[model samples]
Target: MTGTGALARMQAAFASAVTDGDEAAVTAHLAGDPALARRRLAIYREAIGANRRGALRSAFPVVARLVGEAFFDEAARRLAAVAPPACADLNRYGDGFPAFLSTYPHAEAMRWLADVARLEWAWHEALSAADATGIDFAALAAVPAEEQPALRFSLHPSVRLVRSAWPVLAIWEANQPGRDGTPDRDEGADDVLAWREDGRVRMALLAPPDAAFVEAIGRGTPLEVAAGSEGWDFAPMLVRLAAHGLLAGFAGPQSAG
Candidate 1:
């Protein structure tokens, strides 16, 4: 193999050993006493496992705290083993964790934990999304009333919607800094709206109508069609969206529908 090819092969073998705990390729590739190589590889594997656990702990602090550190660490390690990092960026590493927790046998007792994980992930994503300018409502108002129905409004990239059958917003807020009271453990469904504001991530519980409106707008649905949806009421939702700087811009009739 050429030098680049040889390096790629070695890297692949190292990844296999570290991620899967398979030592055969590593044992053959390393130049050292067989026993020493195995021991050193074991050390590297342990370090990687620890790193994955730490990454998860940071990403899902509430989840870790709720489960207790020891159990969280073990769960993180097992999750990492199954869903090894696909990229070098750790920020994107825990996308599968929420789903994994839903089916995780040990987490069966804490059914709401997975929903909490989803809320945390949304917050994390919103924090990293790009900044956006506020909507041009003046221009929107200038459009002909008859044509306004075809206008398409854009959502800020930082906005995220997370729906759950648990009171995820209450659970998340209770875990925030300087919080004292326990969450209600309310079984009613909730839809959380998360976005970046003033360079910090903020989350709020959205009523069903508002959630439906925001979700439709985010998907580029036309104003008329979106407003006609089951739970939509244009005026109030528009005011809320504008106040929070959620609307990015709009495409008028000729530009959109």
Candidate 2:
């Protein structure tokens, strides 16, 4: 095998040994005395496991805190075993964790835990999302009145909308470092808007109509349809989103031509 091929093979073997407890696959790659090599490989396995667990813990600190260290650690271990990282970047490793938690048998009692995890993941993504420039209001204004309704606006890359039956936003806020207290009402639904602004991740609770409007726009709906029923004032919501840097840009009907 070429050097690159050998390296790839070794990496695959090491991953299988660490993640599956199958040391035989990687045994041939180790040098030195057989016994010492096995012992060192064991150490390496433990370190790799710890790093995976650490990545999970870092991504889902609120979940870890809520479930306690022992429970969270085991869950993390299970997740790593089932859904090993596809890429080397551990920061992007736990996108499926929220779905896993929702179906996790031990987590059934805390029904809201999964939604809270989703919120945290959104916050994490927003923090890491690429920076974007705001929309050109002058360009937007130049569109003729008849063509305005066909315009489709784009949200900032960091914008994420999360709607959950539980009070996820309140739960997330309450679990923040040094914060204390439970949500005032846990049963009510919440429409959360998460996005990055000025290099900080920010989350806000949106009213039902506002959430629907934003969701529609996010789906690439034309301005006319996203505006919903006639006589309902959507101008304020547009202004608010634009003011917050959530509006990235817009494409008119002719742009698709």
Candidate 3:
């Protein structure tokens, strides 16, 4: 390999050893100065450790509470080793964790964990996407009747919808502080729409079709198509969006047919 290729190979080996538990390859890659190699690799190991755990802990605080901090830390380590940060921004680190948990043997034992992680990740991402001011109703009202049919609305940055095949909202609620009453061990599913209000993520339960309709709109389906959706009442979808601060305002519009 040329100099650039050789350097690339060295870095790749270094990363693999630090996060992949390949001790033999790690030591070999270090070669002449084992101490220096070990020391240099240690920085990456420490960095991946801190960023993964911190990001996961921030997103899944309640799950951490249920599992306790020490156990959570150990689990976070395993998770980090298997799926370290790919994004430069550590804030985006836990995006894949829910899927990872679903496949992890231990996580299969606690089936609820995957969904909990999903909910947490949604909140984390929604809190970071670009922000928008509250609906500009005045500007919307100014649009002429003829132009109302071409408007499409954008959602607020902090608004997010999480759809799960588990009772994620109940699980989340049972673990919350003031709401930590009796726990429900029932098998159920729910959708949740979360958003930041006054700088905190607020979550509200959503019905299935309502969740589906919003998803359809996000997919660029027209308002009329989304609202008149077959087998689903679109009114409730509107209510949920209004309640969650998801609606920034109309963009282009169509007639209220």
Candidate 4:
């Protein structure tokens, strides 16, 4: 076991070795004293588990409020056991948690748990998205017609657009720190537009068309000139993006209306 195979075996051992009750196989392979190897393995397991748990906790603070502390911890622990972290970057952990919660036994009762998880993940992603020097409205308004064609547009890194069938925003707001409100899904579901500008996460409800507009930009659409997307209102889209600082400068595409 001294060649590449040995290295492969060593890697496999780490996952297997980290289990709380198993150590005999891995300890025999290690060069160190058996007792020392077992203890070290235990330490690694605890540290990794703790780090993963903390990341999950941070990603789902709102969910934690909806469910009490003890329940949240138990669910997090179970989720860790079910879906181990795929990347070492703890900041982006729980990216797949939304799908996981969709089937998680304890969370099955809450059909909206998955939606909340998705919203939380989006919030986390928005916080780390590339930053922009907010949309320069003055410059945009000043551009001349001929120069506009060549003008390119880009978005602030913080802009993230999310659309869900669930009344996600209302539910999230209902569980907010100072919210004295009620959950009224029947009122309407919402499209949530979020951006991390001014060093904080800011979110608002978007009309269908406005959401489509931002999504178009996100999918690499140049500042959309035309409006009336599907059945959504363009005014809401314009107003919301302008307000949240999602507008990055738009460059002129090859041609426009």
The global C-alpha lDDT for each of the candidates, from Candidate 1 onward, is 0.86, 0.89, 0.74, 0.74
lDDT of 3 by residue, 29-130 (tens): 566787787777788777767777887888888778767888778888877877777887888887777887788786566787888888888788777777
Q: Where is model 4 more than 4 Å wrong at Cα?
A: 1-12, 19-24, 30-40, 135-153, 178-187, 222-226, 229-236, 255-257
Best by TM-score: 2
Clashes of 3: 8
- Can you write out model 4's per-residue Cα lDDT over 122-226, one digit (the tens) per residue? 899988877676776776888787665344455677776668888888888887778754675645667888778787898888767667766766665544344
Give every collision pair in model 1: none
TM agreement with the true structure for every prediction: 0.92, 0.93, 0.75, 0.77
Could you tell me which 10 consecutive residues in candidate 1 have the lowest summed lDDT?
228-237
Can you tell me which runs of candidate 1 are displaced by over 4 Å?
Answer: 229-232
RMSD of each: 2.0, 1.8, 4.3, 4.2
Residue-level lDDT of model 2, residues 194-218, one tens digit each, is 9999999999998889999999998
Clashes of each: 0, 0, 8, 12
